[model samples]
Target: MHLGQLAQITIYPVKSSAGLNLTQTQIEPRGLRFDRRWMIVAAATGHFLSARETPQLLQLLVQPSEQGLHLQAPGLDLQVATPAPDGQRQVSVWDDELSARLADSETNNRLSDWLGQAVQLVYMAPENQRAIDPRYATAAAQSVSFADGYPILLLSAASLSELNRRLLEKGRGALSMARFRPNLVVDTALAAHAEDAWKRIQIGAAEFAVVKPCVRCVLTTIDPDTLQREPDNEPLKTLIEYRRSPKGVTFGMNLIPLNQAELALGMSVVRLA
Candidate 1:
C-alpha cells in the first residue's frame, strides 16, 4: 500500500555541519554514502563537537568532491583532501570510542581559525566500525557512522505540518523541516505522528526496521538559517508539552537499513508493518 512519496533526502556528510540534499543516493550498511563520515572534534579532548554546543557549526557548508570535501564558512574556503588512513587517532562520540583518520595539520589549523577554537577534522574510514547500540540493533555487527545513534532518521511531512499547526495555535511561527534534520522525509496522507507506530517500512528498493523513536535534543532548537538558538526554545519547548516519553521528548524515527539499495526522491514508500 502506498503510504507516501519520498519528498526529501538529506545527508550530513560532516556531522552537525550543514547538510546536502540529494535527488538520489546509495544506501550502504552504515547509511547513505558519505553520510556523517566525517566529524569535528575538540583538539584537546578528542571529543566530538556538534551544533548542540557550538551552533556555529551549522554555518559551515560542506560539499563532497571527487578528491575530498569542500568546506565553506564565514571568510574561509578550503578543499581538504581525504585524510590518509595511516593517521589514526582515538575519538569519542558520546559513549562510542573509535579510531578515525586525522586530516592534515594544515586543514586542522584552518578550521580552528574559522571556529575561533582549536578543533580537528577527522574522517571515519570504512575500517572504523562503530557498532550501533546493542539493544536496538538488528544484528550484533550493525554499525553506524558518526551519527548520534542510528544510521538513518525518518520523518513524515505530516508530522511537521501537525507540529506547525500546534505552534501556530500558540502564536509561535512555523519551523522548517531542516530543524529536524531528517535523512528521509516522506510526504504521507496519514495523520500526524502516524509514523510513530510504523515498525517497518520500504523506501524505493531499501527495507528498514524502525528501531526507535529519535529523542529530540537541543540541536533541534538551533535555527539552521541564522545559526542561532531560539530564545524560548519554541518548538522544543512546545514539543515537551506533549511529545515527552520515557526515552525523552521524541519526534522522528530512527532506522537501521536491512539491505543495501538506492533511494530517490519521489519513490513510493510502503509501510510494511
Candidate 2:
C-alpha cells in the first residue's frame, strides 16, 4: 500500500523449528543458507514431518555451524555434520519427490527416541531439487529447499498488529509473530495485509518476486514456546473468518529470489512491480 521497511530476517536451519535471526545474509535460490536445508521425516514412510503433527519440533533451536548446523531442544542437543550425497533416501514433500541425504543410523535413533517416534533428520543434497510450483513461481526452473513450496515467506508487522486487535476485541489474548514463522518481517506502517498486492519488491540489494499468498495451516495453531495448541485456536480460526480464498485461508506472501541477492535487517523495501 505504501513504503515499507524490512524489520527482521530469520532462518529456519531445520524445517518447522525455531528460526535464528541474522543481521545480514546471502539469498540463495533455495533460500537463505541453511534455511530448511534439513528436515525430520518418518523413518518408515519417508514423508516429511513437521510441527503440524509433532509440535515437539518447535522446541528445537537452530544455529549454523562450520561443519553443518546445531540443534538444541529441552533434553537433547545435536551437532549434525553436513552429509554427503552418497546416502540416498527417497523422501516426499507435498507432491515433490526428491532425493535427500540421509543421516546416520545413530543420529536417527537419537532423534527417534527423543520424539518418541521413528524419525530421521535428513539434509537436502546439492543434487536434490524441489522445483517451485510453476503456476506461482516467477521462473519455471526455480527450485527450493525443504520449505513448504516457495523460497521465502514475507510477513508484514502491520498484519500482526491488526490480528492482535481483532483477538483483543474478541476477548482473546494476543499471539506473537513467531506463530506464523516468516523468513522476513516488514513494517508496513498501518497497512494490514498490504503485502498481498505486491508483485515484486526490492529489499536493499535483493530483488524478490511475490509469487503467492501463503496459506495458513494447522502448524500456525501451535504455540512456538510451549509447543501446545491454544484452546481456541483463536488466530487461525479468526483469520479464517475473513481471509479465506478459493485456494485456502491465507496470511503472508511467498517470495522467490530473482537473482543472487543479499538482505539485511532495517533495509528499506521498495515495490518494483
Best by TM-score: 1
lDDT of 1 by residue, 92-195 (tens): 99999999999999999999998899999999988888999999999879999999999999999999999999999989889989999999999999998889
Q: Whole-model Cα lDDT per candidate?
A: 0.92, 0.87
Per-residue alpha-carbon lDDT of model 2 for 94-175, expressed as tens digits? 8889899998887888899899999998899778988888888777788999998999999999999988999899988888
The candidate 2 region of ten consecutive residues with least summed lDDT is 62-71
Cα shift from native, residue 96, model 1 (Å): 0.7
Looking at candidate 1, the ten consecutive residues that score lowest on lDDT are 58-67
lDDT of 1: 0.92
